[model samples]
Target: MTTEEQTAVHAAMVAAGADRRPGGRTRTFHALLEGWGVEVAGVEEGYAWCGPEFDNDISCRSTLADVWPLLPPRVRSARQPRLDELDERFRAATIEWPGRGDEEQWWMWRIPRLLVIEPGDPYEGGWPAGWTMMPFPKPDSVRVIT
Candidate 1:
């Protein structure tokens, strides 16, 4: 975490009265970020991407409002910004999949079963030899990693 993020975290803790007495969830999240070499946090659940930075302090399922207060200046926005060319007005805000096409999304969503990310190529590694190439799933649940 950058100095800014650290400060934000501290302020959030104080404001929320988070228990930061060591070995807590917040500490754990910080440890993960340290281990992952995430320098610039990106697209947090609440805050917009603070420009391709790494963040372990927040995750998906986090309410946009609750974490909004802790967001750094870089990501704070008065209105939610439209990412890429996603037209929220024309598209349903959420999508679900049963590994099959849904008629409801045929015209509204860029849909069907989507492979969220296609790696440049599949990875082939075993433990310490190529750990960085491991197929890692980023934090997805609402629970904070820290």
Candidate 2:
């Protein structure tokens, strides 16, 4: 992950209030990222896409806010700056998919998605291998990768 991207993921993790411990779910997610060459230091129920010069973290089970109460008061306070930093760095990537807000997302594993890169950030390796490619309305839109 690039420095900016790493910061974004770390910030997002803090913001999501993800529990810092590794469990079965976290291990599964970590292995997946590792196979993709993404450096994963922590594991949780969510998945992260981090690689050399690549930056993005996606969580399916939790976001910082979802698990806020689970975090210690000190940790919560420390995360404010990271959260604040993320507000400016990250932007929602519009994705056209069925049941965005509903529980019926076509790609069930992509929930709690986070796009660490900006709208115009240059990315290489384009969605990794085996990702279903579809035309997106805009560069800022999230493409459905089956």
Kindly report which residue stretches of model 1 are placed more than 4 angstroms away from their true locations once superposed: 1-5, 17-23, 27-60, 75-146
Query: Per-residue lDDT of 1-146 in model 2, one digit per residue for the tens?
Result: 44664455555455654425455233222233233222222221122333321223433223433544444455556655754443322222223233343443222222223334434445453543223242322233333222
- Candidate 2 residue spans exceeding 4 A from truth: 1-56, 60-63, 92-146
| Reference-based lDDT, each prediction | 0.30, 0.35
RMSD to the true structure for each prediction, in A, is: 13.8, 12.9
Model 2 lDDT at residue 128: 32
Give the per-residue Cα lDDT of candidate 2 at 9: 51
What TM-score should be assigned to candidate 2? 0.29
Candidate 2 at 104: error in angstroms? 15
Clash pairs detected, candidate 1: 25-146, 26-146, 29-146, 40-53, 40-54, 41-53, 41-54, 43-49
Worst-scoring 10-residue span by lDDT in model 2 = 37-46
